[model samples]
Target: MEPFVLRGPEATLSTPTPADVDRVAEVCADPEIATWTTVPSPYSRADAEGFVTQMVADGWANDMMFTWAVRPPGEVDGPVLAMMGISRTVGAPGEDQAGEIGYWTAPDARGRGLTTAAARLAADWALDPEGLGLVRLQWQAYVGNWPSRRVAWKLGFRSEGTLRQFGLQRGVLRDSWMASLLPEDPREPVEPWPAEAPRP
Candidate 1:
């Protein structure tokens, strides 16, 4: 699986390089990021280096995960505005394919649609028959993450159901909200936005 870049009208996503290590560490240090994401609480420079130099490289080379560093549209050297990825999983014995999508936006990049744009680019690429050829994409967030839910909703992920203590955050199992998008799904809100999120 060769590393690739995805571009959209509002975002560009490419694999992270060693140069992004500092910014990665800085973003991961955000208290909100630590609370919502599974990144190390006491995230260190070493962790960022591993992510940029090892985890990201291995994930792409092994075809297990395809992660990208999001930036402003067409700005390859711009600051990392967010991070998004798809962790692929083998489906049933004969199923085509499926994967889980995950992402986090940099503090200063929130409130705008950059994160959503990046996600749309990832989803479009991953689900394209001529691209990853995946049949389905799954999105899961801790039950209280309304921001994540809104993004998933805007991507047309149908609210499936909830799994009690099914998602591991940091270490403990927490209740999780689950949703799914298929290749044929429309890229529009599939259901009413959850109450936690203000109506669009």
Candidate 2:
């Protein structure tokens, strides 16, 4: 299947390429990724390349998941900054047509509110009838990853609940915060970008 590009207020989501492997490796080496994500502890260039070649390329070909690169607007002279993605269309047997979104920005790319904006865009697209008809969009982040939790909250995802020690990262089990938005929630108000949080 041909990869499709998705739009956001300030980012353009596209499929990853071999040329991006080096940039991905540079960003994955950041401590922030190690702190919040499941990236390898000693993340190396080879690991990034292998992942780009296998998990991203082969995975997309096999219909396991869809990946995208979050290119920042106005970046024209250097490495194209990117974010990793893994999502399946809703209702493919056990998936229930529910698309879950997740992302991480480069180190130098933090504090810009880009991820939050991009997430809202991605969610809107996923929920569109032409896209995935996703009845629910979910986000899960480690308890202490305030940045990610903040993005979810900013995008109108309510604090549904938490799963205690539901994930194992590195060598320890960690608690995860789970939040979601449903089609009938009426909480996702239709308005301008950065919509106000619906009153609970």
Candidate 3:
């Protein structure tokens, strides 16, 4: 798939490039991101380069994942505020069409609602017939990741309960919280925020 951009009033989402490696490496060093997401621990410049030249490349070339960096509008190679993507392995002849959303924010970018805005744009596009045409978009995070859970909820993903050792983060099995958003669901909170969620 050709690279594309998603623009919104607050941010512009664009594909990452080699020019972003320094900033990407710097941001991924945040302990919070390493703890909550699958980005490599002790992230390095090499890892950042691999992500852009490899994973990001393969993902788009194969149409299995569509990733975008959240940056201030028009600063394509500037410091990245956050990153997100929708991913899925397309299944056989009659299998269900589904994908999952994933994201992480630069530590300094937290509390700004940037990641939530990015997630909304990606989810809506993935579900629109004019976009990816997916029937379902799922959200999963290791248990205790309240911020991620809150973002999914804010985007109208119905809480689907927890699964034991359901996610692998850097190879270790971890319990996970799961939820899903159907194409027909309203793009607004459908359930009240859980008390455990961090207050805004």
Candidate 4:
């Protein structure tokens, strides 16, 4: 599939390139990122290179995923502010089409709403008939990832409760919170949620 770019209010989302290796390595190396995400611990230059070169390439080629590197608007060549993607999900027999969204924000770019904006853009694109035309977009995060949960909630994903030992982080099983956004759901925030609600 040919690569494409999606421009949003605050950021531009595009395919990752080999040129982004160094910056990707630097950002993924942050302990906070490693702890919260599945990114390799003690991330290395080689890992970053493969992520941009091999992983992204294969994902697009196979139609299994679509990954985008987010940057400030009009700064497509600038440092990556975050990485986001939707992966096609292999559902059970007789299930509707589905995909799962995942993302990680750069440490320096936290609290700027860049990821949220980019996520909305991606979700819109994924649900468009001209795009992937997926029926629903799933979201999951290890329990306690309030930031990620907030992003999902802000996008109107219905909280679907928790999955026990749903994810593995560094060889340890961890519970995860799950949610879903359907084509019929409003993109804006829905009913107010409890401030103390558990997060994925």
Candidate 5:
């Protein structure tokens, strides 16, 4: 498949390239990102290269996933602010197609809402009939990943409760909070903010 790009008001989503390996490694090496995401614990230049030159390429070639390197508009050649993607999910027979979303923001880029804006762009594109044509989008994160959960909630994904031992982070089983968004769901937050929720 040819590389595609999605431009939004605040960010641009484009295919990962070999040139991005160094910056990708730098971002993934942050302990906070490693702890919260599945990125390699001791992220190396080699890992970053493999992710861009192999994993990202293969996923796009096989139509199994679509990843975007997120950068601020007019900064496409600069360091990435985040990485976001949607992966195809197996559905029951006769069910509409579905995809799962995941993302991680650079430590230095936190608090700017870049990831949230990029996510909304990705989700909207995936749900478009002229685009991926997916019927629903799924989101899941380790139970305490309030930042990720907040992104999902802000995009109007219905909280679907928790899944016991649903994911493995750094080889350890962890519970996950799951959510889903359908084509008909409002794109803006529809419910009152929970007082106890942490700021994303």
Candidate 6:
């Protein structure tokens, strides 16, 4: 796997730096974090910084995937305000040519459509052959996480199915909604927004 670049309408994607862990930890500590993600409760700066180191090293040594900090557009020299990442493939080294998208926005950045725009930007890049050599992007969200699913649909992911007892979250087995965006249809009907359904 090779390094790739992805950019959002309001943010640019880059490997997360240690300095970014503080802000990222704050985002992870948001009350909304555990509601939608597998992120652990009581998120700490150590956990945050470790993720940066681990994710980057994994991307290179294990060819797992790349993670990036999403910084506000035109403000390229500060700590990232959010995070968005994509896996290189499903499980093994290489088989599916598909990637899983995940993201989180800072508490102060909520309601600004940051994550939505960032997700769209990631999908666009991953679907490009020059980028991840991906043919599809998969998104999964906990049931009732309308915000997350909305971003996926806005970015052209079709609700494909649901995974029952998929995994544990906050000590409970939960159902997850799954969706996909194919490379063939790269144009998102709606500009990335916080609410609404996928345009037919």
Pick by TM-score: which candidate is best?
1
What residue runs in model 1 are displaced by over 4 Å at the alpha carbon?
92-95, 193-195, 198-200
Question: Which residue segments of model 3 deviate by more than 4 Å?
Answer: 90-96, 193-195, 198-200
Clashes of 2: 4
> What TM-score would candidate 1 get against the native?
0.95
lDDT of 5 by residue, 1-200 (tens): 56698898799899889889999999999988887889888999999999999999999998878999998885666678899999889664356789999999998888888988999999998888778878999998887887887888889888878899989887699998888888888997776643135657
The whole-model lDDT of each prediction reads 0.89, 0.72, 0.87, 0.87, 0.86, 0.74
Candidate 1 lDDT over residue span 6-68, tens digit each: 878899898989899999999999988898889998999999999999999999998889999
Of 1 and 4, which scores higher on TM-score? Answer: 1
Which tens-of-lDDT digit does each residue in 1-200 have in candidate 6?
55444655577777777777777788888878867787878898888877877766577466667777888775554567777878866544355577788887777777787878878777877788776668778888777777777677767777768899875787898998887788887456433433454456
Q: Please give the distance, in angstroms, between residue 168's alpha carbon in candidate 2 and its true position after superposition.
A: 2.4
* Backbone clashes in model 6, listed as residue pairs: none
Predicted candidate 4 versus true structure: per-residue lDDT over 1-200, tens digit per residue:
66789997799998888889999999999988897888888999999998998999899998778999999897777779899998889554345678999999998999988889999999998877678777889999988888888898889988888999989988998999988888889997786653245556
C-alpha displacement of 110 in model 4, angstroms?
Answer: 0.8
Candidate 3: minimum summed lDDT over ten consecutive residues — where? 88-97
Q: How well is each residue in 51-143 modelled by candidate 3, as lDDT tens digits? A: 988999899998889998889866666678999898874554256678999998888888888888889989989989788878899999998
Which candidate ranks first by lDDT, i.e. highest? Answer: 1
Please provide TM-scores, in order, for all candidate models, with all chains considered together: 0.95, 0.83, 0.93, 0.92, 0.92, 0.84
Candidate 2, poorest ten consecutive residues by summed lDDT: 189-198
Preferred candidate (TM-score higher): 1 or 5 = 1
lDDT of 6 at 7: 59
The per-residue C-alpha lDDT of model 5 at residue 7 equals: 92
Q: Is candidate 2 or candidate 5 better by TM-score?
A: 5
